[model samples]
Target: MKITRILNKIDRRFHPSHIYALQPDHDLLRENRTYREAKDIVLLSYPRSGNTWLRRLLANSILEAQQYPSSIQSDIPFETVVPSIYTQSIKPPCLHRYDEVCHRIVKSHEHRDARKHKTVYLFRNPVDTLVSWHHFVSNSPSLLQQFPWVVDLSIDEFCLNAVDGWAKHIQQTRHYKDILLVEYEHLFQYPHQMLANILDFCRIPRSNIDLDQIIDNQSIRKLKSVTHSQELRKGGVGHGEVELRPSTVTELRQYQQMLNVAWKPQVERSLMTAM
Candidate 1:
């Protein structure tokens, strides 16, 4: 067991692709300015809002269609298909390749910027998102150390903080003309249709692509089984109903009111019933 743990640590430390695991407060905007400027497509979301899942789906679809090497499969060093500027290490070979790729698909969790990239904004219910994020950080020692508040606060307190951040993120980017809004619930419920919609929005041809294959490949179970990382936790929807405290539900409702989110009524109703 000790040897196995040691090997796991070594693999995580040296893995080429693990470099894309994002650190808190990463200065991706400043470091990746040139790549961002040239990128034609972006997948934007708040942390824990299904960004990785969507990235994997898009990567598998596009790479397979292009007949790229199988070595760069969904969760491997597959950032090239859709480079996540925020998470990818800004070093030599990756940096050089990022600059060279045209119409690149970049992932970001930062506030919306003035770049003209066609954007897909993935959002989830703040309640579930926070719950997932709380568990995610709690499981990741590195992430918990980076954001110590995750350890300092109860899940309720964390959700309260998360709601405010989620509101601000939504307010910042929801108005963009070129942005496509894809809700996590919708994606969970209708994977194929949602994938098709995303492809259509991105102007990618869906006729030749097998949506079912992409959906199967990116299913939550498949991702969790394949990845050794704890990031992919229980992938079902609406866990907040059972998991979140009533106080957190109230806090989220108030935030929705303050932000004047369009889905406020629906979310509030859900929260009330959940509580």
Candidate 2:
């Protein structure tokens, strides 16, 4: 028993994936305790659910044209404007000094809580999200180590699992009265309109915000061109039919039914307002 326990500890130390699964909440609390007081805007989503793209959009919208590049390389320093709580190595400035800034956006993928901070939850089709996530995790060595299950599952299995996962994510955050829910498909379909909505949700005046320029610069083509990884591949909706097998498609359809039932009212309301 002692030997087994010691081996498990050693395994977790060497394998980050095991550690993450075992102590996700503890890790999140430890890493994000500082930001509890000062988070101004919470950008919440499941992993691979358009968080990075939205961050780019928000950062570019806020930054001056010259300061924000047209084509962003993988290493662009936009974290100060829209930092991710999950990715930050040091203490987040937003936690200490959000009042000093005009807009502080913090990204997260945790389950929703009762925090009163303004939140924007991004929702993508689970089929597309899972497909993207699978490719993303499979391609990145670090991600593979952290999420070894991605390598073991077929695409259909992943989508079936992701359906349940995303449904839970939606159920958790859907009821937040102050939250603004944004659909990933709409962001692509109507970039100007969605950006305008997001800017409004963040309480930024659209007067000086050039929606045209931000949309053009942050378009999927431009983003994919600069991002040299599978993470940004084919950033459009309905690609799941192409990438996922027929069995996966059938399974995803059933999952989509559950998602629509849970999210239809909120999503419809958002779309109506956007229209």
Candidate 3:
């Protein structure tokens, strides 16, 4: 038993998945200095929760608004447009064409440091989030190269381990004075209105950019063709209920109940009914 426990400890110590694990507050600023330096706006979400899609959309729109020649704006490297903690450790030079908001928007999956910046929190139903996250982590080439163990995890095991982080993220960032809550489903159902809301929240002028053109440019089909990215998946809702196990659903619901208790006054936005 002792030897087995020691082996388990060693396995976890060297696990690549620890890259996504929440860091202690003291180490967070040092480890995620790019995130700490982000100005005005930060886009926050748990992994696989539409953060990438939204970031690309915003970046493209900003470039268009600035009237960047189509050639320059055609392939907006999202990591460059919005300094991401996951992608860039040193701050990349800000693209010159777009205004200050473009430089200020940063993307992050972790939660603890969000309160320091005005945040746009994107959340999805926990069931769908886990299902999508499982697919992303298991299939991502970079993660698999170093830690093939991820592909071996059953969906149940993955969801069970990951269930708490979603709620914990909400708990930490919900009350910040400058936060905007964006539900992922709303992006699908009401793309125009949602985009406008986010632009307004981030203080980007909507008049200069054609919202319709930006949305079309950022559509999943066009983005996939242009970037050949595997990260963009089938992005509509309800996959969680269809893909996850019954036990996993129940566990996720329990977490939803906790989320409800956390934001009971905002009953209309409750996950209990939303999911």
lDDT of 2 by residue, 179-239 (tens): 8889898888987888788888887665556778777877788877676755567788898
Model 3 residue runs over 4 Å out of place are: 1-17, 20-38, 69-73, 89-97, 101-103, 141-152, 264-275
- Give a tens-digit lDDT track for model 1, residues 89-145: 434356323323234677776544334668888888777787887787678777655
Worst 10 residues of 1 by lDDT: 1-10
lDDT of each: 0.63, 0.67, 0.66
TM-scores for all predictions: 0.74, 0.79, 0.77
> Which predicted model would earn the best TM-score?
2
Least accurate stretch of 10 residues (summed lDDT) in model 2?
1-10
Q: Which prediction has more favorable TM-score, 2 or 3?
A: 2
For 101-169, candidate 3 gives per-residue lDDT tens digits of: 454677777655576788888888788888887777676666566556666667777676666666766
Residue 113 displacement in candidate 3 (angstroms): 3.7
Q: What's the distance in Å from true for residue 25, model 3? A: 20
Candidate 2: deviation at residue 271, Å?
2.1
**Which predicted model would earn the best lDDT?**
2
Candidate 1 similarity to native, TM-score: 0.74
**What is candidate 2's CA lDDT for residue 194?**
81
Q: Predict model 3's lDDT versus the native.
A: 0.66
